[model samples]
Target: MSEVITDVPTEAPSEWARHHAVPTREAYRRTLLDMARLDPRIFCVDSDMGGLEDGFGQELPDQYVNVGIAEANLMGVSAGLAHSGLLPYANTISSFAASRAAEQVKIDVAGNNLPVRIVVTHAGVSAGHYGPTHHALEDIALIRPLPHMTLVVPCDAAETEAAVRATADLPGPLFLRLGRARTPMVNTEPYEFRLGEARLLREGEDVTLVATGPYPVVMALEAADLLARQGRSARVLNMHTIKPLDVAALGRAARETGGLVTVEDHVRIGGLGAAVCEAVAEDHPCPVRRIGVPDAYLDFVAGERSLLEHVGVSPERIAEAACDIVGRRG
Candidate 1:
């Protein structure tokens, strides 16, 4: 039998190449489409792109519904589907899906605790070339505050597939953040993946870098390289599942590292950093650094690289922050 592990590409690594298979967000949609093939009860609602780029409509046309460009109506319709005992997966850009449909998600989805899965594509700096309007820097912060919402940001396509499978088991409002670009898969070793459980990618003793989404892979790479250069290691944790934060692992890292640095392709406020602070500050107080887009929108004319560097969330910036935090502790 052809094994799934053997299917992975066997190639040489370059100095600065990311081994990105499928974009995590697209993989989620593809997996969902495959699941829909057998489960006739599955329905997908698109916010224009579903029929266009996502290709979800191509697989299951009868179960697919497009709500034009009206996001509110789309959420309302999806919630209604969930209430009627139909599992609905809504697809849209991250910003529009979360912030634009905030009320609908809070009321129709969260308020009712319905089994409506919201899959956000082209999230964060991955949409950088498209400009800040398309960048979903605040989506994570916005969605975390809502009740009955399981916030997730899968690190890679494989984990994304695992996340989709997990979503099928859980029955409630789930927000899965996915990027438009191909991201490097960090987890080659298999584990029992689940939503709301944090995955520890790398171990260290100096400091802890708690990151979510595709950015965490970059964080791991940065930490590894930086540790080799400085002869000091930093632990990195992939807090993919944000809602039910793995406080146990977080507590362990906090005790081990003493210093915490959170990297996210999100807002500095109400995002992964804030969540870490809330979790860490509950009993023990430690110095924490939050890395993400600041308060102001990137209205300035710039590409994705510029936007991230300007906001100081780039890999280099993350390394610098880690170095600074580690240096200060000495």
Candidate 2:
């Protein structure tokens, strides 16, 4: 269904996506393989869960270690590998990879500034039916305060792949957030996704929608539908990377659009909303609407649909928030 890629494609996000063969996790794995091939010292330490669609369990047996159910050991071993000079990527569910092993991550990865990259899967409500145990709703908050760490939340499969490729050579600790569902592949068509740069999906004068990670698709579609029905134009910005935010873009949007709305799957407090507020508050002060989970744990939902609806992250909610922000309510 998806074509394989040896190198990044040269097409635009508006063009047909040429390569989608690799899912986000496998994309990270492929990057790891590339690094491992280039230097024999590169290693990957996985929890029992790295049972990917194409498991690299055997091909790189010596370079791979699958520790069963022990998230803490994965952090410790990854730190040890980093201390010994082999760049390692530790893999697990985001909640466990970050929260369950916060001390090890703080002491070993952040405290020591290890070159270990933590690839967290099933981030946000994308975990769907796995319930609260698997839903990593607070992962961004958990990793935000750590020092010497680079935080990234990629928009689609392409950005995820690029983030993986980029983190391979980056110094110090890095945390890559990924989704569980087959999110829209709109971002696959080559955008210039530098480390902390944000991409402007649309330009508008009425209002701006700053969306991050997988939820940008929701916001983009909502903005388009709103434009069609009410002629209420909305600018959508893709803020994949959470930390080191694009203050210039925020300034332009604040000056141009005059109002703002931030949509993300993570909690409202230490995420994209907070980052946007900090930037927009300085030069162009505007009314900011944050669309995300509030200060409460998400309840168990039947599926992703019920999950998003329960927490109000659906496209309709986003459109409503956009309209409310611009005073366009019918």
Most accurate candidate by lDDT? 1
Q: What is the C-alpha lDDT of each candidate?
A: 0.78, 0.75
Tens digit of lDDT per residue, candidate 2, span 83-174? 89888878888989878999999998899988989988888877777778888878888897899888888876677767776667788999
Best by TM-score: 1
Model 2 TM: 0.88
Cα-based lDDT at residue 85, candidate 1: 89
TM-scores vs. true structure, each candidate:
0.89, 0.88
Q: Point out the worst 10-residue segment of candidate 1 by lDDT.
A: 9-18
Per-residue C-alpha lDDT of model 1 across residues 106-155, encoded as one tens digit per residue: 99999999999988887887778777678888888889888889998888
> TM-score of predicted model 1?
0.89
Off by more than 4 A, model 2: 1-18, 52-54, 328-330
Report the number of backbone clashes for model 2: 0
